[model samples]
Target: MKTEIRFTHQSLVENSKSGDRTAQYQLYELYVDAMYNVSMRFLGVKEDAEDIVQESFVDAFRNLDKFKYESSFGAWLKRIVINKSINHLKVKRLPLAAMDDNEYHLTNEDEHEYQNIDAMDIMKVKSGIEKLPYGYKQIINLYLLEGFDHNEISDVLGITTSTSKSQYHRAKKKLVEIINTL
Candidate 1:
């Protein structure tokens, strides 16, 4: 089922790359909702998410020629959307702090603290994440929800890998605290 969908999506992308207007519209329709949700997760504002999604689609179509099939087109488009969202956040002056590598250490107990987080209600967890400070929320969203590893996150957010790890840990701890309060 998934492979067939990918093949159809690939065909649509190829047509879009060739400047086929109908195919481009179809491709936009296919991805817009998911991309909007992703943008919403990052921005937490409907207006911002809507604007970013529109901008991201325009940018994706304009740059479609540069895309290779190395990864799925959706994944490629998603990267563009995420980057745009992050750029938007940066423009808002959201301070993503860099941590000194020697300042904090990760331990087994810290890992254990997060292990049971999955048992919480999804909506509750999401609410907890939303209450986090901007930097922690971004790290939690990128790592836990978007599945970006620390290295990729560091690259995207212009921080060190150690900072990413430390932030993620702090985010988790904060999220747990938030959940407990609720």
Candidate 2:
């Protein structure tokens, strides 16, 4: 049963892995838009997102044989897109050394407030996320929207787990403020 779930779009993937043009084209058509959106959420630039999505598809197809189906094809492709987008950001961004490390932990009162926010509007949150600075935006996109835990975000961003945890809390606080004004 686990294998069955992992083998989503198996036939198309297998055919594409074997260099079947039609199968590859079908997979491209099925995933392109979703991949573009994922890239856009991180890159925040239309041209960069489009280029990254295109490169992701190319890399995915080129490395198709290496895909073992441990994850769904879409998930695998999304990872490539995310990695490329993050790398793109890293190239253009600076290190976060200016912030104090002690502010990493959230207090009980902050946690309670964070939990009680009445943010039922997805569009407002999305817009607020878009307005966030690059550092906060990356943390919010990775932790909240992508459902990544601190460990996974740390691994992806090459930061410590504690740093990831702190950054996410800080980013969420900023997001809440932005959402309120929206």
lDDT of 2 by residue, 1-182 (tens): 34322233899999888898878888998899999999999988899999999999999999998899899999999999998999999898734334665766788888887774554587887888888888888888888778889899889989888888888888888889998898
Per-candidate clash tally: 0, 0
TM-score of each: 0.93, 0.89
lDDT of 1 by residue, 1-182 (tens): 44333337878888888898878888988899999999998999999999999999999899988898888888988998899999999999987655676677889977888888999998899889889988898999899889999999999998889889988887788899999998
Candidate achieving the largest TM-score:
1
Per-residue lDDT, model 2, residue 42, is: 90
Q: Which 10-residue window in model 2 sums to the lowest lDDT?
A: 1-10
lDDT of each: 0.88, 0.85
